[model samples]
Target: MNINDFYTTRKNVFDKLQSSNTATKILMSLLMACFTGVMAQVVIPLPWTPVPITAQTFAVLAAGLILGKRYGALSQILYIVIGILFVPWFGEMTGGLDIVLGSTCGYFLGFIIASYFIGSITEKYAGSRKFKRAIAVIGVANFALIYIPGLAGLALWNYLTYGTMLSISSLLFMGLVPFIFGDIVKILGLGAVSKVFLPKE
Candidate 1:
């Protein structure tokens, strides 16, 4: 083939490849959001607390590990918008502004922040196949991010509406204690699964 013709053909092929990659990323983000919504349905209510145990933490961490910071956080944002506007995809199949502004609002906000941080950390170290321990440590740290906002939201909501202030110990008991073991499992699971899926530089 002529040199100019060869160059033109190569350019066209490269453009197509780039387009495909972009489409794949967009599809993955949407799918991850949907997966999170599905996870939200796997809820078990606690008698003493308003928050329920669900599969969302696992899905959130997995999304971060697989999609990196920007797209991972985007997926979570999409999930939150979907829950608020259309489907009852939040825990217990509940949704709407009421839920978003209710006692669990902090946890929802925490999800976005944690997803971004987790994805950022994984992309930085895990992407190069170095400092694998960073992934585990960051994953655990992100759990605290989720809990901090969650507990604060719970306490604030109760105090504003019921004139009852929950002590630090009470907040921890309701928001953190019951969930620690399960969240630890989720973090470790994310680390294990990241090894299988995260790309190496």
Candidate 2:
């Protein structure tokens, strides 16, 4: 088969995953929550920053792209709520109210907001295959939407924990700089498979 044929086949397969059914959407939210939970387990702690490198970021973005705004946000809500209620699927198999108010909660908020934002933007591309546009939006959502809240949460965590004032540059180096490459990799990977999750009118 030719390249176009391969692309079409792959597109069709993934496109089938998008559904308008309420039941299906509910199932998707649960499935994505589980997926994020599973991905959260792959944590690599950094010495400089408390934020670990987990594939959960990728999973979170994927859930938004695939499930669209409402269900996407719902998925993250389920993930957070269940984790807090004692699912123990959070990073390092830890969960509870402490995690909610902990240093990383901002990213959890980011995940929900980013998912909703991504899903909303992707909806605008319903019938079109605008690869560059999709990538750009994904980049914006991942970098801006996620990192803004994340940095705030991290800084708050540091202040609450250390009682020391830090500079903005210090916050970036600790919370943002280390994760730039990883998020870029995720953006490229998701952009490449844009046909799969990007909406089809």
Candidate 3:
């Protein structure tokens, strides 16, 4: 075929692929999973806890913020799927079911639920001119869904009971306090990054 004919042919194929729902879902899921894998690579070890800080939270936030609720949850679920069935995509290492049985499983699973909530809230506020509302939803969702559950898992693993672990002071020091600053920074960064993906609505 001539060069122009070939170009047109390729364009038509690309457009057709992009228009397919399955193609879109697979593409977005892979993109988010890749981001999760990459984010897990940048680990910041901390002395106080086995759960060291990492950019994986950034990936989690972005997955939710950009993908919205259903797709965001699907992306995280896909990450778990790939990690279990294929390669171990968890931070700084790789393993099978043992990874889930380890100390970090709570945080890992929490990312899925958290991403859905964060994405949902962000979707609502996205169309409003009120950046503050967007910021608030983003902040609350990240803190409540991701951090709270994550740290609670750690606390429970440490043998802290539900009532005690859920206490304000207990959550503050064990979960919220140590990570608040870091979470804030991540939230801000993710918010800025989100603007690139979310349309001007």
Evaluate all candidate structures by whole-model CA lDDT and list the values in order: 0.77, 0.83, 0.69
For candidate 3, lDDT tens digit of each residue in 80-191?
A: 7788778777778674776655557677778898888877776665452134445566677678777667776777765632334445665456555777788888877766
**Cα-based RMSD of candidate 3:** 6.8
> Who is ahead in lDDT, 1 or 3?
1
**lDDT ranking of the models:** 2, 1, 3
Model 3 has a clash total of 0
Find the candidate with the highest TM-score and give its number: 2
Q: Can you write out model 1's per-residue Cα lDDT over 25-141, one digit (the tens) per residue?
A: 777788999999999899989999888888887887767666777888888898999888998999888889899889888888888888887777766764532236645555555
Q: Identify the candidate with maximal lDDT.
A: 2
lDDT of 1: 0.77
Model 3 local distance difference test score: 0.69
Model 2 ranges off by over 4 Å: 1-19, 127-129, 196-201
- Write model 2 residue lDDT over 1-201, tens digit each, in one string: 987677676667556666457888888899999999999999889998888888898878877787888998999999999999969999989999898788887899999999898888776666523567666878888899988998899888888899986699998888888888988888878776675534344
Residue 157 CA error for candidate 3 (Å)?
Answer: 1.7
